[model samples]
Target: MSGLLALLDDVAAIAKLAAAQLDDVAGQASKAGVKAAGVVIDDAAVTPKYVTGLPAARELPIVWKIARASFFNKLVILLPVALLLNAVLPWLLTPLLMIGGAYLCFEGAEKVWHLIIPQKDHGPQQAETLDAAHLEEQRVKGAIKTDFILSAEIMTISLAQIEIDTLWIQAAALAAVAIGITALVYGAVALLVKADDLGVLLSVKGRLAATRAFGRRIVKSMPAVMLVIATIGTVAMLWVGGSIIVHGVHDLGWHLPYEQIKYAAKVAAETLGAANGFVTWAVTAGLDGVIGLAVGFILIPIVTRVIAPVTGWLFPEKT
Candidate 1:
């Protein structure tokens, strides 16, 4: 009886420890997810457009396909690469993050530029001619490729955010974050894509007046919702990109920009007289976004002419 009691106590202790470790992992994962919010927003925003022209019937299926590819990209490809970098080239993380940030800034700035100076569409009209199946395949491939870049950024950001002692903890945190963000983004996309159809059905077929009214409101709200999401995504990308570059510069011993921004934020906070940390942070982020936009605009032409050609050559398509 004594021996059995001792063994039971030991098992209980082990179970308690395991539960503590899981709690720690979940806490870390949530923190990491919050840290990668910008990339998450961009991922969500970019995905919906890929499904835009597809038939309503095909939308969810395409989203599922892309979501699966995104999982593979994050879990299989980017996760291993992130872990390898954490183990081997840890010093490279900041610079690599800065590069990813620069990409975000470039994307955001290009959007703004297009808005400022609309362009005539003169490129090859290839996709419109593609059959439905081919078009679906192409969109899925494109979305997955885009997801790879964004997922890489998200994983790197999440990895950097984790404050853990062991490799296993870091890995678990990253995996959790990756899976959580993927589910949230794709799940939201599925809902958003299907929302209108659901609304129409309810509006036309609902037996209750309130149901029809609710459906009408949903249909009316969708366009504004998309516009708001796009705007939020763009702003987030620029803000996060700029903040990363600023911090990277500080890490590299250039403190001028970081100091100036901090000072400006403090002044703004004092002027507001009691707004709270969120407002101050928002002000700081807006300033950072302006700086990032300027840097991105400068890089755009360089990227278009030089980087694009080099990347294409180095990564020539397989026959």
Candidate 2:
């Protein structure tokens, strides 16, 4: 009887430990996911456009396909690479993160530039003649390729934020973040794509007049909502990118900009007595975004004039 009781107690203790570990994994994963929010928002905002012209029936299916590819990119490719890098060359993380950050800044700045000085479509004005299926496939491929880059950034950011000691714990936390972020991004994309359909159906078929009005409003508001999301995504990219670069510079022993930004934020906080936290954050974000925009503008010319030509030469078929 005593032996059986002891065995039972041991099992219970083990179960408790397992539960605690799971909780820790969940908590850490959530924190890591939050840290990668800027990239994640951009991912969600960018993905919806890929399905824009596709058949209504195919929207969710395409989103699912992209989500599956994103999962593979994160779990199968990036997770292992991140772990390998952590184990073999941890110092590489900062440089790699800064690279990703620079990319985000460039992308965000390009969007802003396009908005300011709308580009003339100089390429041959050709209508897309591809079959629907082929078009869908092409879009899916493009989205997945983009997702791969974004997923690499997300995983690296998550890995950087994790503070746990155990290898297995780190792996579990990363996997959780991967699955969670993929679902969150693709799920939001799916809903955004289908929202119009839902609105149309409600507008036409809803029994209540108010319901119909609400549906019409939804249908009307979608474009503006998407615009807002895109704007937010762009801002997030710039803010996060600039902050990363600034911090990276500091880590590399160039602390001038970082110190200046901090000082500015501190001054702003002191000026705003009641809303000190909000003021500080706003000042920090504003400075970071300005830096990001400047960097991005500098990169745009280099990329368009130098990188594009070299890439075209290297991959002539793609050009």
Candidate 3:
């Protein structure tokens, strides 16, 4: 009986240790996820547009497919690559991050430029060319390609945030963050896209006046909500991109730009003394975004006139 009691105590201790390890893993994973929040927000914001014009029945399925592709991109392709890079070529991470950051800046600036000067939509011309199935496949493929870049950034950022010492722990943390964020972003997209249908059903079939009114409100506000969400995503992309570049520069031994940005942010905060934290953060982010836009605009001409033609010339297509 005494021997049995000793074994029970030993088992209880082992169980407690297991629980503690699990808690640690969860905590680390959550921390890493939060660190990649900007990328996650941008992901959620961008994905909905892919499904915007699809048939209602197909929207969710397409999102599901892309989400699966995103998973494979992060886990199968990116995770192993990130791990290998961490082990072998840690120095390259900063440059790659800067490349991703530049992409974000370019995209954000392009959107703002488009909004300022409304371009002629040749969308109808292209739409007339492709049948529904072909268009769907093209969009999905395009979305997956885009997801690969974003997923790489997400995994890299998450990997950087992890505090674990072992490669396995780091991998697990990254996987957890990738899975969680993908589910969150795509799940939110699925909801946002189908919300109108749900609202219509609720508004028509709701038993109570309050329920109907709430549904009506949802339906009415959807357009504005979508615009706001899209704007948020763009802003986030710019802010995150600028911040990443700043950090990348610092990592690469060029500290001046980063220090200057931080100093500017501090000064801005001091200028608006005692205001809400949001106000301070907004000021900082806005200034950073302006700086990023300037840099991106400067690069635009160089990229378009110089880089594009050079790449085309270097890689002529096969007949």
Candidate 4:
């Protein structure tokens, strides 16, 4: 009886310790996740556009595909790469992040270019002529590639939040953060894409008059909502890309831009008084966006003329 009680006591202590470790991991993950919330919002905002113009039935499937790729990007690719870089060459992370930033600037700039130049509209006729599966493939690839950059940023931010020296604990916390953030982002996207379909169903099938009316309103409102989301997503890409470059240069010891932007925001904040906080943020973001746009314009021709052709020749896209 005494021997059994001793063994039981030992097991109970171990269980308690394990539970405590899990609690610590959870706490760390939550804190790290909060740090990456801005990027998380950007990820959520940017993803829905990929599903736009896709078939209603295919929307959820496309979201699922991108979400899966997001998981792989964070866990299999980014997490290991981040840990390796942090351990061996912490200085390299910022440069790599800036490269991704430049790519974002290019993408956003290209979109703006199309808007300004008003490219030949590929309307329903073009969509009908093209193989939709190929289009789907292209969009999925783009989303996944973009997600990789965003996920890298998120993982790096989470890794920075860790004060723990233990490797396993750090890994556990980062993994948790990655999974949690990805789920939240893609889940919200899935909901946004399906909302119209849900509204249609409700409008057609609901028994109550109010419910049907509400559903009809939702159906009516969704197109505008999607447009707004796309606009926000494009602006966010520019803002995020530009902010990354500004901070990247600052990290590389080019402090003038960062300082100037910060100073302007501060002045605006003082002038605005109670609305200072928002005005300050707006100023900072606006300056960052301008920088991003300039970088984008410079890169657009090079990418379109040189990079695009080289890539097309080398890779030869199927569709």
**Residue-pair clashes per candidate, as listed?**
0, 0, 0, 0
Judged by lDDT relative to the true structure, which candidate is superior, 1 or 2?
Answer: 2
Which regions of candidate 4 deviate over 4 angstroms? 1-42, 49-55, 121-142, 157-166
Better of 1 and 3 by lDDT: 1
Q: Report the Cα lDDT for residue 241, model 2.
A: 89
Error (Å) of candidate 1 at residue 293 is 1.3
TM-score, per-candidate, Cα-based? 0.93, 0.94, 0.87, 0.81
**Across residues 149-210, which tens digit of lDDT does each residue of candidate 3 receive?**
88988887777777776777778787888888898989899899899998998899999999
Across residues 141-175, which tens digit of lDDT does each residue of candidate 2 receive?
Answer: 88998999999999988998899867888999999
- Cα deviation at 146, candidate 2, in Å, is 0.9
Structure candidate 3, residue pairs in collision: none
lDDT of 1 by residue, 1-319 (tens): 9999999999999999989888888999999899789889888888988886678899999999999998888888888899899899999999999999899899999888888999776323655777778777777888889998899889988888888867888888889998999999999989988989999998999999999999999999999998888889889999988988898899989999999999988988888888758768988898899988987999899999999999999998653
Task: Give the poorly placed runs of model 2, Cα more than 4 Å off.
Answer: 121-127, 316-319
The root-mean-square deviation over C-alpha atoms between each candidate and the true structure, in angstroms, is: 2.1, 2.0, 3.0, 3.7
Go through the candidates in order and give each one's C-alpha lDDT: 0.89, 0.91, 0.82, 0.85
Model 1, 219: alpha-carbon shift in Å? 2.0
What is candidate 1's CA lDDT for residue 152? Answer: 88
How high is the lDDT of residue 73 in model 1?
87
Q: Per-residue CA lDDT of candidate 4, range 133-199, in tens? A: 8778878998997898888878876786777767778889999999999999999999988888889
What are the clashing pairs of model 1?
none
Query: How high is the lDDT of residue 54 in model 2?
Result: 73
